[model samples]
Target: MQHIRALSAAKETRLTISVITFDLDNTLWDVEPPLIKAEYAQQQWLLQHRPGAVDAFDHEALLAFKTSVWRRHPALAHHVSDMRTQMLYELQIAGGYSEEESRSGAKEAFEAFLVERHKVVLYEDALDVLKRLAQRYILGALTNGNADIYKTDAAEYFEFAFSAESIGTSKPHPAMFKAALQKTGMTAKQIIHVGDDPDHDVQGARDIGMHTVWVNAQRKPWPSGNKPDREIVNLRQLPEAINHIADAR
Candidate 1:
């Protein structure tokens, strides 16, 4: 790896990280609660605006509607906003709504969910660690989700937020990682990708020659023999773990 200035106090012979890319969903925040809330938000909106659909399509029927939408528009699977909108529109149509009515109603329903979705509850120390790391290294976000970095207080600390819609694909795909490097003008070795996923965050960036830090919040077992360069149980440990990686260089 090419020698670069270390961000941490610990010095290394050849520390290569200049930019740090993060995965947003479960990495910085517990996505489950907000997502569950968002779905409920959608359901509430449908209940108010399209009682017919809400009453007709129960849990199982809605699930089948979602499946059909994905089956028809497989590419939208990674684009959260579009996927939800498309699914809502399909459900509206199936509920006896006209084409124009379905489209407009779906857009409105998706907005209800989107508002709740952006109201995320970040993990403990996530913002603090990001602030500490941003002082020395460029910080960017790479994600498959629709979480708008601008909506969060932590937005100011991020240099950029790259997402599936912007990139036309999601993580586990090298193109997402490649896009981050190209946009930042940083070499793979000059960046470290940190996230909670083995495939999307760790393996994808690893394959591109970027160092990886797996934030294992769930404490799940590593699924493969190959492992990330570093692992941490919580966001609080990130700064020190990153420092350790730099020192190892």
Candidate 2:
């Protein structure tokens, strides 16, 4: 294992953090803008190709349909991409298309959504912070969403990336963190997981004994009495937070 030694400020003893795992969406970038754009893109596809469906279903209706689809197929709940595609397929069928046509149309509409979805805007300084952090610690990503870092500019900095789609489960389930630990051959204490979500990211990693850094850009109060080991409002504060956690060890 590669270790970077730093003198603990509190204990004045050597400490090391070997790996840093991250949550992609809302952590590295603002996810809402692109998601809105992606939804628009999908709607545009429906308007052009499945006009009746577009006319019948508004945003709220589509959302309801998506929920129905999800409930119908509980086994694939973790697969967001698949769930979306399935919803599109149902929409196409409802639009008076044949089964074969609905299948192909759903696939194409999903492609449209994905193209826009991948066009995410990274938060300012996120790339620079990742670049700096990558130099010292082994960097990896664990995302609950279907966003693929490989398709984004952040791919180069990450040693490995896993999504709930690939792992068959999402964060807060130990499987994601355990997979990272297995992949990096590092113990929970030797890794730090950073993310924006209070439940999935902060509490999830902490549950498994890994250090956590909550990116509370919204300035929300800590939900529970048990708080994260470290907190920051932006990516620029990330390195220092990691150091602070390391120093305390």
Candidate 3:
């Protein structure tokens, strides 16, 4: 086993960890549930608000539409809010609503979908881990996907939340990490980033000198080419990892 150093009590006190940026989606909650629920809610909205239009559409068709849209506007891939609006518009058009009516219905349905989407249950240990870590480090959220952490009520724990939609840069690009550093006014050495993706979170943070913790919740094999500075299978192990890094310093 690769042993990591532990954070000493004195070092933990003196070492000011300016920020702890997190990846929002899988890192906090199991993404599949909320996403599936959102799609279902969106479909239901289409059936009720714009009936007969979906007679020709199905779940696969809806997904295909979204995929095509993203392929055409890759920049909007991370913009979930914009995507929701577009999806509503597409649903209206497919259902045979007039252009003006489709626009109006989309606005209403999109807002409703967002509310339903936020009813997500996070990992069992998510809040506990964040609460413990927040006592020592400045916590923030850095996500490549556009999820409004601010609306989730979990934003209370994060000092700041950033997304590719807001930053104009995505992970593995290095610029997003730099933006997080700028927001906290801390050097790369002062903060650590924790997330599930090796390329986007681990390698991206490590490339810029920020320590990284890989949250391999699924137990997926670590890809051969990219490796993280630290790896843990559960959120329960995170506090220990941070303490280890702090101890080493």
Q: Can you write out model 2's per-residue Cα lDDT over 1-249, one digit (the tens) per residue? A: 233222123123224677899999999999999999998999899889888976787779867887898999887878899988888888888889999988998899999999999998889998899999888888899999978888888777888899999999988889999998788766788889999988999888999989999999899999885699999999999999999998888
Per lDDT, the best of the predicted structures is 2
| Candidate 1 C-alpha lDDT tens digits along 108-219 | 9999998999999878788898888888788889999999877887897887789988888889899889987776666788788999989999999999999999999889
**CA lDDT, every model vs. true structure:** 0.85, 0.86, 0.76
Superposed model 1: Cα runs more than 4 Å off: 1-15
| Candidate 2 clashing pairs, residues 3+ apart or interchain | none
| Ten-residue region with minimum lDDT total, candidate 1 | 1-10
Poorest stretch of ten by lDDT in candidate 3: 1-10
Question: RMSD for each model, in Å, please?
Answer: 3.9, 3.9, 5.7
Over 4 Å off, model 2: 1-15
lDDT of 3: 0.76
